[model samples]
Structure formats: C-alpha cells, structure tokens
Target: MVGEDIDFTRLAVILCKPDAVERNLVDGVLERIAAAGVSVSARTDVVAEPWQVHVAYRDTLTDPGRAPADRPAYLEAAFVGRPVVVALAHGGPDIHARLRRLIGHTDPAQAVTGTIRGDLGSDSIAAATAERRLVRNLVHTSDDPAAARRDLATWFGAGRPAPVCDFENISVVLCKPDAVERGLADDVLERIAAAGATVTNRQQVTVQQWQINVHYWDLLVDADWFPGRDIPACLEAEYAGRQVVVALAHGAPGIHSRLRDLLGHFDPPHAAPGTIRGDLGTDSLTAASAEKRLVRNLVHTSDDPDSARRDFGTWYGARRSGLLAPLLPAQIAPADA
Candidate 1:
C-alpha cells in the first residue's frame, strides 16, 4: 500500500531488461516514458540476485501446477547474470496502465509498433520457443497497480527502515551534455553510487537559458564567487543549448562536498586523476578561454545545502516532493507516548 495513495497520481516500476542495457537503449526508453509525461522518482542499476528475480516474478516462477514447465526456468535464467536498470516512475492516476502500454506486450512480435518493445525489440515468443528461451523483450512494466506497489517495495525497499544520514543531505548532480553525448552517463552514475549515495529522482532534459541563469546567478553576478569572471558569456558559451541528465542524490552529511569531490575541479586539466572530470574531461580553462568557451567538465553538483534546495526547485518542483517528502522526519509520537 506504500504507493497506493493515488490522489491523482500513481507509481509504476519499469525494468530495462539486460538486453536493452547492453544495447544502450536506457536513455531512449526513459525518453519515451518522459514523453508520456511520466517522471522517474527513483532508479538503480541492479545485477539482480536469483531471489530478487524470483520475488519480482513470483507468480510466474512458482510451480504452475500446469503445463509449460520450462517457461519459468527460462524467464529466471534470462534475468540472471545481466545488469538491469530498475526505475520507479510516477504519473497521473492511470500511470500503471500507461506504462504497460508504453512498454508493449511481453512478446515483442505481438507488441504494436511505436511501443518500446516493438521499436527496440527483435525477439519473438515463437522464435524464443523454437530456441527454447524466454522472449527477449526490451523492457518490463508492472501488470497492475497492485503489482506496481509490490515491485517498488521489492526493488527499492519502500516500507523498509530509512538509512541514517548525519545531516539528511540531498544534492543534485547533472551529467552535462558532453557526458551524455559520449555515452558516459552510465559511468558517471556508477561513480555516484560508488561514492555511497542513492539517486532518488532523475530527468533528462535540454538545458534552458533561464534555468542556467538561475542556477549560476551568483557566479554570474557576484564577482566574489567567480573573482571577476563574466557570468553571462560563460553561460551562453557552454550550457546554452545542451542535453543534460539531472539527478537528485541523497546521502549522509557532507554529501554535497562528497559529490563535488567526485566531480573533480571546475578545470579539467587541474582535476586530479580518478575523479569524473579528470578521467573523462580533456578541455582546459586556457584552451576554452582562447576559444571563448567554457571548460568541458563532465558534471555539475550543488556546492551546499542551500544550492541543493534551490537547484532541486528549479529543475523539479512538485515532483521533488515524491522523494524528499517521505524522507522528512515525523513529528508525532507513538501511541506509547
């Protein structure tokens, strides 16, 4: 029942199958979901354990007490050893139904064109049956609202105890256009996870001039922050028209600083090796200045709590409430009180 508080919104789960991930279709699948007006509230890449897969498809994996005995085993095998992206998507009251339709039928050949499976998938049940394998559909969505709730909990621990945070910090990390264009979004996300944070909300969007202005208002106007740097020119030269992957990550105290460290220095040449920018970025401030462009650092992170809150507001208004609201501490005492 964790996700059943409909009240004009519903929660759904989408699993980008291993084949989809291998084919690098995660971004396309997410884009389609967002095109349908669904927002991703939480996401994680999982190399699922057998038990997790069993829990995810409990009905199918159970002894059917009928024919087609090999179906369940084939399905289970398909899920094992492959990395899948598990995402929690929220939308209007009919979100569950919408996602099912968006993802398409279980058998790729039977799915209608334009749906994810029909567009990206090439395998069929008939061919799979002939090959004695499970249909290699590109994605999976909950069959119903009930299943959505169950799968969310199963994958994201909805009802489980919250992880303790020293300051209950939340920060925003943006994978800049260059990173996405280079197919480094997954690598960046993996590094974020490696740094001990959880991505609670994510969206892929083209950067707007106004949002960039607001995001860098201080650096643009306040010489104290940039020490005589020209704000407007910097903004126009770098972020004016670019695609960016925005994500909200939560962790213990100092999460903002932790993310900043992981992102490396603003200047790629000066960034220490092993950090995101140092590892992936090649542009230098001198070179960029000569070209009248901004350094091609691969990411952006909030510098502090205030900036985190501000950036979250600018990128995701009410949608932020879905993940942030539940994390707030309760004020009421227990009945024993």
Candidate 2:
C-alpha cells in the first residue's frame, strides 16, 4: 500500500486543549508515523470556531424533534472558553498500523499511558477551565475514504491537483525567522516557482494561539480524550505573544510540498541540508515521523475543489467559488484570464 497504489486517504489529525500541554503527546504520535516512513502530504494548524462545531454536530442535537436552537447555550458553554488545534495530513500504506501502535502507547484505562493523552494529561478539564482541566491528547485522523474525502474538503479544499486558470490560490506560508535568518526565502520561492506554483499574496504575520486554534477548528470536542477543562486560559496564554510568517502562492499540484521541503520544521537546525529546511531550519524537533524535518511541518493545501473554493473565498474573496460555479454563475468568465 505504498506510493500511488494506495488511495490518498485524508486524515484530520486534530489537537484539542493544552496548546502546549499536548505538544509532546501529539509530537510522539507524529514521530511514530514518521518512523513507519509514511510521508505527510499536507499539514495545517486551525482553531475550531464554535459555530463550525455547531454545524458539524447539528444532527446530533436535532434528532427526533430536537431543536438546535435550544442548544446554543450548551454550545456557548462548551466552546466559549476553549479552542482546539487541527493537524491535517494525508496517509496511506501502513499508516493504520503506525497509528495503532501510537495509540497503544497510552494508558489504556486512564488515557492509555505512553500515548499523547496519557503522558500529558492531568486533572482532565480542571487546567483548561477553572471548573475543569483536560489532558493533552494528540492527533485526530479521518476514518475511511468517504469520510476522508469529506473531511479533507471541509478542511483543505476540493483536493484538486490542477490549476483553475481564471483563479489562483492564496498560498499561506510562514517563513519563520530561521528561514529569514538563514536567507532561504528566495530559494523557497524559486522552488515554489519551479514546481509550477505562483505567489499571489504574502504576509509576515505573527501567529497567536487563538489563530492556531481557530485555524484547526475541526478538533475541539468535549469527548473522552478531552475532559473539557481549563481550555480558555491555555489558549489565552499560547496566543498572547507569538509571531509567524505567511505567504499566498498559487499554481499547481506540488507547490505545497515544494515549500514544505524548503522550510523544514520550525527553523533551520532540523531541516535537511540541501533542501530548504536543510539549508535554513534550526530546530531539533524531528519531522512529523517519516518525513524529514522541514518548516514547522505546517503547510496546508486545498484537499479538493470545494475546499479550494471555500478557502480561496475566505482568503482572497472569490465571489463565485465552487464546483458548480460554471452553472451557478450568471455569466461564464474566461478560464485562463
């Protein structure tokens, strides 16, 4: 199940609570995946918006004459104070085995010790919420292909590998100080161009914990792994003072990988020397398992057409973005304008 034989099953590696609390736990699972030699196709950090959760779980509350309106307060209580991190990845070929091994590392009854949840967790929800604290649980993977496709589209986009000539993608990149410090941005851009990717927008925005949480919104359920404790305070602290670089590139299928390969993870220390990270990265944190260290292991791509359109709309404000735009748009625009 290696290479192209296996379908590119998209997995949403969700992180909820302990912006830092669960860092080690989640990092370990990712390390295990890397150990299996499974390459991570794409990754991103998104904070879960309460509204999005409300919609995703709307069905649960609206069953059999249940009114969703009645659940607003509950939604507010559950999400008002907390935010979650979402790590997105595409996996295939022995990933399940690797993931199972990681899960098995935790304390079975009490968070499955040795796993992300067990080692990092404490009073559960008490730390996250004064009334409650939660332990850090690492990663969330999408189950099955259909769910994978759906989840990928919801988070990454339509998963298209080709370019929409009329529209360009807004590639959001973070050139951590390490990249700039090492002066690798030029080479990174050159690589992106070589891979058929073009930059349409770019920015050097500092990352706030809340932004990370909002970006990774698909996580953050008050479930078994997350005891729904002191989440707000943790988020407040993580987001208070942080800086990150952002870029928006548009072009073709392999652009995201190009940048990822160049940036390495977090800084210059950890990246492969010839590659972008190799030349500029400066972190000891191993690459997310199988892949080499490059960037913070946090570059994102639109998983599908729908997702691309939605994300583009959010980032670049394309008025008519979607698969059905051809039919829905009042007038057809030139495909390659």
> Which candidate number maximizes lDDT?
1
What TM-scores do the predictions have?
A: 0.64, 0.37
**How many steric overlaps are in each model, in order?**
0, 77
Q: What TM-score number comes out for model 2?
A: 0.37
What CA RMSD would you report for each candidate? 6.8, 20.2
Looking at model 2, which ten-residue stretch has the lowest summed lDDT?
323-332
Tens digits of per-residue lDDT, candidate 2, 68-178, equal 454556545554445444343434444444455554432233666655445544444334444432223344454445544444444443333323333233345444444
Error of 1 at 17 (Å): 10
Best by TM-score: 1
Candidate 1 lDDT, 16-116, residue by residue in tens = 88888988999899888877878765557888677778788778756566327776678678887779988777666788788888888888899999899
Candidates' C-alpha lDDT: 0.74, 0.43
Model 2: CA > 4 A from native = 1-29, 55-83, 93-101, 104-109, 123-138, 157-337
